[model samples]
Target: MSAFSAIGDPEEAEEDEFTPGIEPQPTWCPGCGDFAVNNALKKAMANLGKNPDEVLLCTGIGCSGKLNSYFESYGFHTIHGRSLPVARAAKLANPGVEVVAAGGDGDGYGIGGNHFMHTARENHDMTYIVFNNEIFGLTKGQTSPTSPKGHKSKTQPSGSAKDPVRPLSLSLASGASYVARTAAVNPNQAAEIIAEAVEHDGFAHVDFLTQCPTWNKDARQYVPYTDVQDSEDYDFDVTNRQEAGEMMYEVESKLYEGEVLTGRFYKDDRPSYGQEKRSTGEMPEEPLAERYYDEDAEWERCAEQLIDKHT
Candidate 1:
C-alpha cells in the first residue's frame, strides 16, 4: 500500500492538484445554498497555506456527501452518520494531516449523534462542518434533527411533533473546543469561520445553514440569514458557555431575525487528545508502510506473534 494509505503522503500534497475533477456541475436546485458553501470551503482550504492532499475530507452520506467528489483532497465518502468516527480515526492515524468531516444535520446530529458527542470531548484536532437545511434533501423531504417544530415533511406529514435539534447549543454542551455557525450565501464569512475552525487545535464544529429548495422550500425565509457582515457583528461569545447558551436561545426566539450571529461561538486552546499521546515533536521521517510493515518478512513474524498471543 502507498504511504498515504497509512499516515498520508505529505510529499504528494499539491495545491494545484486540489482542483475538483467532477465533470458535471452539482445537481442541486438553481437557488440551492450548497453552491456557496462548497465555494467557501474551497476558498478557505486555499487560504490555509497547505497542499490539498494534506487535507482529508471525510463526509457522510447525503446530498452533502456529494461534496467529497468536488474536492481534490483525499476524500472518504462514508456511510450516513459515521463521518465523525472515520474522521477521528483518520486524524489519529495521521496526526500531521488536517481532517475535515462534512455532513448534514440528520447524518451528524441524528444518526451519528454518539460519535459527535464523544469526538467533542476527545478534542481530536479536526473540523466538522454540518449542513443544516432543516430537512433531508437526499431522502426527498424528510424531517431532520434541525427541522423546526411543526414543520411538515414526507417523513412527518402531520407536522413534526418533536422539537428541532439545536446544533449550536448541543455542540457547546458536547464540549467541542471550537464552535461556530455560518450560512451558505455568505461565502466570505463562511470561509473566515472555517479558517478559524481549521486553525484551532482541537475539535472544531461549524453549523452551516444552507437552503434545500427542493425539499425545504420554506427555508427561503432564512436565506437572508447569510447577510451578516463579519465576525464583528456576530455576538459569538467564544468563551463563557453561559453566553453561548443565551445566544442560542435568543437566536431561536427571534420573530424577524435581524443580526443573525454567524461566527465563532466558542473556542479554547486545550491540548488535543492526539497531542497528549505524542512523545516526539515530529513524526517519523520514514514511511509508515516501511517502518511498521517491514518487507523482509518482519511483518509476518509480528503478525504470527500477535496471533499466538491472542490464541
Candidate 2:
C-alpha cells in the first residue's frame, strides 16, 4: 500500500484499545482537568474506529505533554511550543496518518503563538488542542497567556496587568478552517468536538478550558457552561465567517467574566495544504515517506546541493 493511503483496516475499536499496554499511571494531580482531555480523545478515536497505529499524537512540554505516555499511539513528545511543526511534517510526509497536536496555554498561545497562527493560515489537516487553564500548571502557577487581567500568580504577585489572550478569536482570524471551544468539565462535548475536529479536512483548533485547581484555584471550574448549539440564547451559522467571528468574540469576552460558553463556533470547507500541493503537482500523489523506503529511488539532497554550490 502507498504511504499516503490509509494504513490500517477499519474495525470496531473499544476505548481500551487506545490505552497503553503498560499504562503509566497519570501524574496529574487529583481533580486535574488534564485527565478529561485524555479520556475524551481516546473515546473520540475509538468511536471513529481508528487504530493506534494509524494515529500520530504530538505533544509539547507541560502537563498536557504527558498524553503521549498514556495513549497507545505513534507519539512524539516534542520540545516546548513545537508540537505543531513536528505534527505538520509528519502529516505532510504521510497524509494517511491521523495527526493530533496538543499543548498547554503557555506552550501554545504564548511561546508557540507564531507557529499556531501560521499552521492555521496554511490550513494543515490536523487537530490542535490547547489546554487553557489560565495559569501555568506544570511549572507551578505562573501567569499564563490566558490568565484573566489582574489575576494574581506567583509570577504576578501584584496581579497581571496584561489582558488575557482571546484564543477563539485569534484562531478564527488566523484562518483555522474549524474552530471550537470545549471544557474538560464537559467530557461529552469535548469528545464530540474532538471527533469532528479529527474528521475535518483542514486545520482544526480546539481551545480546551481546563481548570488548574492545583495552581489557579480562584479560576472558575468551567461549570454551568451553555452549549451554544443546544441553547436558545445563541443562534449563528457556523459556516458563515461573519457570524462565527461575532460569536467567537462574545465567547472570549464572556469567559473572563465568569460566563462559560462551549460548542462548535465555526467550520469551513477548504482544501488542506497537502491537498492543494498534490492538486497543483507540487507534491507527489504518493507520500514522500514512501520514497525513502525504495532503495533505488532517486532523491535530491538539498543540503549537499547547497554546500556544493557555495563551495
Top candidate on TM-score is 2
lDDT of 1 by residue, 104-182 (tens): 9899999998999999988889999998888888888989988877888888889888977778778878889898888
Candidate 1 lDDT score relative to the true structure = 0.76
Q: Write one digit per residue (lDDT tens) for candidate 2, span 15-121.
A: 88888878746779999899999999999999899988789999999999999999889999999999999999999989989999999999999999999999999
User: Best lDDT goes to which candidate?
Assistant: 2
- Please report, as a residue range, the 10-residue window in candidate 1 with the lowest summed lDDT: 6-15
lDDT of 1 at 184: 76
Candidate 2, which ten residues in sequence have the lowest lDDT sum?
1-10
Against the unseen true structure, what C-alpha lDDT does each candidate score? 0.76, 0.93
Pairs that collide, model 1: none
RMSD of 1: 4.3
Query: Candidate 2, after superposition: displacement of residue 85 in Å?
Result: 0.6
Clashes within 3 Å, all models in order: 0, 0
